[model samples]
Target: MKNFLVHSLLLAVLLTNSCGSSKINKTSNPAVPAAQENVSNQAIVPAADQLKAYLPLLKGKKVGLMGNQTSVVGPNNEHLVDVLLREKVDLKFGFAPEHGFRGDIERGEKVSNDVDAKTGLPLFTLYGGNAKQDSIVKSIDVMIFDLQDVGARFYTYITSLHRVMELCAKHNKELIVLDRPNPCGDQVDGPVRKDDKFKSNVSFHKIAMVHGLTVGELAKMINGEKWLENGKECKLTVVPVQNYTHSSIYKLPVIPSPSLPNHLSVRLYAALCLFEGTDISVGRGTDWPFQVVGYTNPVYGDFTFTPGEKAGMVKHVEGKGAVNYGLDLRNINPDEFKFTLKYVLYFYDKMPDKSKFFARPEFFDKLAGTDELRKQILAGKTEKEIRESWQPELAAYKQMRKKYLLYPDFE
Candidate 1:
């Protein structure tokens, strides 16, 4: 206890000392359009930032946080784990998803189950489909999910959220989802997941790839739709962000994943991630990561980038020790990106070697949540045809999604 207090104090000092001369320009209300957003404005306050509203519920209860480095609070940008410790909230064990507790681990790298070095708290690994264990869920009275989601189906954090929600429902544990903004909340593009097949860790729910809902709203849908075990809903409580709406443009204070290091990358992730199913390198080894898509071929896009073994990019896709040339999309404004299939279609049409383009067909199908897309792409269907194919399903999904929304939607 003494050691934990000392560590907390040290963290407090470290965070306090980080008070820079530059003011934190948080948006006061994000109900306006993105083009109107300014440096002088204050954005919507996240639910985690308003601790007083929900911290009382955790008093005298064993707490378990299912979070990562993205789980932060306030204008100062302090870690939620540290804040809880300071508040004397009894945080029992922290459950880490894909990137691990502190989010230092690489993407899909199996984070080892161990104790947190700073707080001395036992941190369990929930990746690789391991959090469903009965032993872990029963240990906590309240399971707090406070991670930032990029609002993509393949992102994997929401998959963890789905599985954790299921476990919480079955175990009868109080699931508190401290809601954060969906950076891609405004746009609802791409196809929705089919009912049968292609369901995996990435395709947790049947929503569209770029599902425009906060974690809280999604949680409500999971319960409302009776998506849990035997149609049982989890005891869920959503701490919603203040002054946030579906149209509100949320700039992530921290990168949600290792590959997505900035707003541009996060914006491009929904569409560019499709490149993963192909032989293309989505700037994995570069600083841009998801912002650029490149390969060593004349038929590909004019822009080019060579992969390298760098931090956050421990392994570059298909570019091991070799330079892969492709497009560099950094110069383009992220807001201009609609996350449509135009880029993917264009690349597929240009590549001379059609068979060699998609190395992992199954993985691509998994990401898209349907083999129909691949079939359409292979058949040389136009982007309009493919997007039109998604209309019925996407429309149904949007209608269903409206039922569970916690705030103003992107209507």
Candidate 2:
């Protein structure tokens, strides 16, 4: 009776939070209504919450998790690590990506191998390229990947996913991906990555900057396309999100990382992240990271903010201790946003010294997955012209993406 009552209550909230329709409405931010009302006929259940579907796969098998702070389950957003331990799933250890297991560690900081304090489980650092990943994979019978991805190429979690997939394939181990709804899954725009020469941790696969697929679908693509070394495929299984389509506007219950604190920041990430390669500051140390972009010049904007050292949130602050002037996009309508280079282009044109605009042109190319964008911008190409150049490759990528989709597409 107690269990029944709890399940019933959660179900009610789930239904309320969901939008049962699969229609695409690009004119409004669906997050607004979804957060306010739970009136849908069905609940959008993440794969992690559907324990019964995966618990059997773990029965008597030693398991390890490639997860972090966002790897949670249920309406209350309980950590999957805790739930797995409670269920006696024989969880061996954990693999933390860029941010440490708890998401406390700041970006670009080296994540060292350590023991999780609360769980007392060993954690292998996968962010900066661990030397022991081969042996780590050998120790586990099955690997469960449940990190929340914001549907952007440069997020690094997906890169960790690719690394894990490769190791699992190399070791001939089964891999399970507990899928979650990508908040930015509805929009699929931007440049497709070129060949291996431009590949880095951020742009691991030859996918678009805003690749519109769940991690499960991406896992499938990695295997189907034989992108793995020696064309080997991991024994893959994806426990997909229930009642979710590409167009589903699912608000994340937990912040995916330290930098992206809210839906607005996430909505603006793919657009602003490109600025990282430039001198522009994407509000790193401010209260609203990724919600604004500025540089240490008055000509950039009238609104001013000085970044400072923020422990656990930001270290190695960009434009730290200096007044930065640029656009404040905190209140911009989410519906009006699309993945575009107009912001970067605008900043470049406004830059007093165009050479200094691309402070790290090479890094920018890595983020863009090609150097053509930087070259195009230097040549003073319009946004329309740049977007048009991507059409041939983008169209081809769209067709290729169709084979791996697990749900209804936004288009």
Candidate 3:
């Protein structure tokens, strides 16, 4: 089954890659065609386009940058650090986010501090042991953040930004955010975290699961809305993208991280991430993480699905080939479809070998933000019933988010 799925994915990739070159322009609002037309006329450039704007401010000051592989100059594809080094912009040090400076590590993997091979400067790992802002920001006059975010609350990179921003505010250091497009764009979804809820490293802000703001806009919202620690705001400057529309999704020239190779993976991550706390292997070791999930259970053969006339038959036995299966669910509406813990619990309950499924109570609770979801799942509640329990909170969150929205709404 693994081989079959791989072959199917390869076929899809080959077919999609055959299309001719086309420019991916940044879009604003897809709901209103007139608004999209208005945004397109301005012809917004990427954050890298405004490199010259920072040169004057950066001169004679110790500068620190928080960026990864995706931080590059538009059109030329030059690394931002290398460009700054050539222009002699007083680049003091480098800071890496989730996947380190090279963007090679897997999700939740720890990165260690190291020297960059190309620039030979100290690269500090903000995603590992010593991730505190004071540990990496003491000697720098200003800190610039420019990492690509997948626009999901669960994604750790944005939390890193929030932590650094708080520290910058505490120390009174200037913080500049080189904005990029939110891959998910302006379509917000899911419940917002409450003030009394656990707001740890994974969730730093009180926004929805899919907050519809760019990093720059987020900075502004944080400051303007007073969402920071003790109601203190950072001295922030957002280098806004020119002509960027909320509806556009850019095909990044450089891969941001190993797991997120393409937009398809990003799209699927929102739903599949729920399985992270479960024993299911969401294709981490394979080429397509989040695209395929399999387990070593023996009953996989019991659930057989035919793929393309005589393409292959997936057997029910677990472990490798016997348990391999793929899902083609582009037709599902992400916003309307309700997801709850029961989806996972029901599968685990029905599996013949329940011991094969590992359930870490703490880990699952952190991922879902409460043990109630897990407890109810374990108690055999259906997905619909579980979703109904959270409806009131989700509805209240939706109303609260309206005041913070930056784009105009059609509905």
Error of 1 at 268 (Å): 0.4
Q: What lDDT would candidate 1 get against the real structure?
A: 0.73
TM-score of each: 0.88, 0.89, 0.75
Q: Model 3: per-residue lDDT, tens digit, 1-411?
A: 222111111000000000011111222122223333356455557676687666777788888887777777757566777777889888877777765666655555566777766557777765643535475677788877777777776777777777667667777777777777776764665546664455655555667666666776666567656766777777776666666666665455566566665666676666666676666655554455555555554444333222211111122112333344433334555433333343366456766665545465565555566567667766667777777777787677556554433343323
Sequence-dependent TM-score of model 1:
0.88
Per candidate, the number of residue pairs that clash is 10, 2, 14
lDDT of 1 at 403: 66
lDDT of 2 at 269: 93
Q: Model 3 Cα displacement at 409 (Å)?
A: 5.7
lDDT of each: 0.73, 0.77, 0.58
- Candidates by TM-score, descending order: 2, 1, 3
Report the C-alpha displacement of residue 88, candidate 3, in angstroms.
Answer: 2.7
Please identify which of the two predictions, 1 or 3, would achieve the higher TM-score against the true structure: 1
Ranking by lDDT: 2, 1, 3
lDDT of 2 by residue, 111-132 (tens): 7777766667787777767778
- Candidate 1 per-residue lDDT, tens place, 297-407, comes to 756756767777666578445565556666777888886676888778877878887898789999899899998999999998998898899999999998888766666
> Which window of 10 residues has the lowest lDDT sum in candidate 2?
11-20
